[model samples]
Target: MDTAENRLNPPSQLLLALEVRGILELQAFFAAYPLLRYAPRGDGHPVLVLPGLGASDISTRPLRTYLKAQGYAAHGWKLGPNHGPRDGVEAGIDSRLADLAGRYGRKVSLIGWSLGGVFAREAARRAPELVRQVITLGSPFANEPKASNAWRLYEILSGRKVDDWPGREAMKLPPPVPSTAIYTRTDGIVAWQGCREQYSPTTQNIEVEGSHSGLGHNPAALYAIADRLALPEDDWSPFDRSGLRSMLYPDPLRSDTDSEAALRVSLAV
Candidate 1:
């Protein structure tokens, strides 16, 4: 028989439970509100979604489909599987952003998950005029390299040193363009502190109840994304806590330091 400690500590078991819980929560939230099905429509500027480290475009299929159904021109980063820092990767990202902007005839919105979020922010910083807005899910930006246990595994697999990677420096925010970062306290992968952003008027940090692996399918995250995308071109504002009191406790954006600490402790357990 498996001991309670062993069962709880096993990476596979814990990850599976988190994934299951995330799916159940998503179903319950969507079922409660039928009107939440509405997705933004029209030939709006393209929204490019980037997958996390080691994730291929397939991982983001659900999100892309949902965005398309909502009427937005959503696209995947078709640049092969994300394999960490590599030669020509940065240039490739620039080319993709430029191509999308030229084709759409407007600034493109970026929605990156995990490491893809880091890349999206960097692209926005490099060309703010060409980029309209950015949204990231469960990205780690505040902490230094090696902050998360998973980073060690990633480093070993990719044979690249994260500390030497330029992406780490690019995590810094650029000029204000409506930005929203959604994270959860129960994330079993990256530290929640890494997902936070501060010191910007247009930036928002939304705290949802979920695990990192299932953020793409979480109902609260979907609703939040829909809400942000639906906002009129000029009405983009920081996240407001007045309405979400029932959803998440203690607004995660109250203060960067406190929120980061609280989130870190919550996820450590």
Candidate 2:
């Protein structure tokens, strides 16, 4: 009973075309590497990084490396490429989560990119006691399956219909642990609105300016991730965007002006 009228549309061609900016974003990350080192340091906790659709642990290497440098035991899913929730995908994540938590004797934080974020959220939901928090990068968790440009590719890769995925409705619900959804208005793959989490005491949406493909390595996104991960396990607070951060990360909750709304409409189209 789903219809185009009811489902959010994928990003427009303009946004899709802008995905190439990911290259520049990557360069920017390297250019700012020295500066990034001063971003934030983390406790010696375990952190799991999951890749997006069709991407392997390779895509997350830079992020995992950065986390490791920040004093956390960063890990990759090690399950080949992410091809949706195929047979053993869920089990693999569960096993990894248990293994890391058991080894570290501490709850692990989950940071996922794109489809990986969906997996991370669900993993935390299934085992909140084992998860410290969840952070998603450019993940359209709140949208219908077809609302992303990669839906067809996801089907082709996973051999599963996007709409037929079980527990699809529950995907929109934020996990019990602290959750952060990082999104970009100029994202080239998924509708930016779909990347938002329902606001709650422990749920937040961070608007970063970057391409969907580069969120994993984008400097602003990277700093935000480091900032979030550096928080104490027992003390959770919404991200502070005051001072210089305000200029880099726009207020997601601010009322969009006519121009902003128009731009959003264009991207959604």
- TM-score between candidate 2 and the true structure: 0.94
Pairs with steric clashes in candidate 1: 40-70, 140-194, 141-194
Q: Which candidate is the best by TM-score?
A: 2
Candidate 1 overall lDDT versus native: 0.72
Candidate 1: regions farther than 4 A off: 1-35, 39-43, 167-170, 174-176, 248-250, 253-269
| lDDT (Cα, 0-100) at 113 in candidate 2 | 99
Model 2, runs deviating above 4 Å: 1-6, 256-269
Prediction RMSDs, each to the true structure: 7.1, 3.0
lDDT of each: 0.72, 0.91
Q: Deviation in angstroms for 135 in model 2?
A: 0.3
lDDT of 1 by residue, 90-161 (tens): 688888989989997978888988888888888788888888888999877655665554676668646887
lDDT of 2 by residue, 1-269 (tens): 56766667888877788889889998998898889889889999999999999999999998998889888999999999999989999999999999999999999999999999999999999999999999999988888778888999999999999888788778889899999999998788998888999999998999988799999999999999999999999999999999989999999988744433566686689
Worst 10 residues of 1 by lDDT: 5-14
TM-score of each: 0.80, 0.94
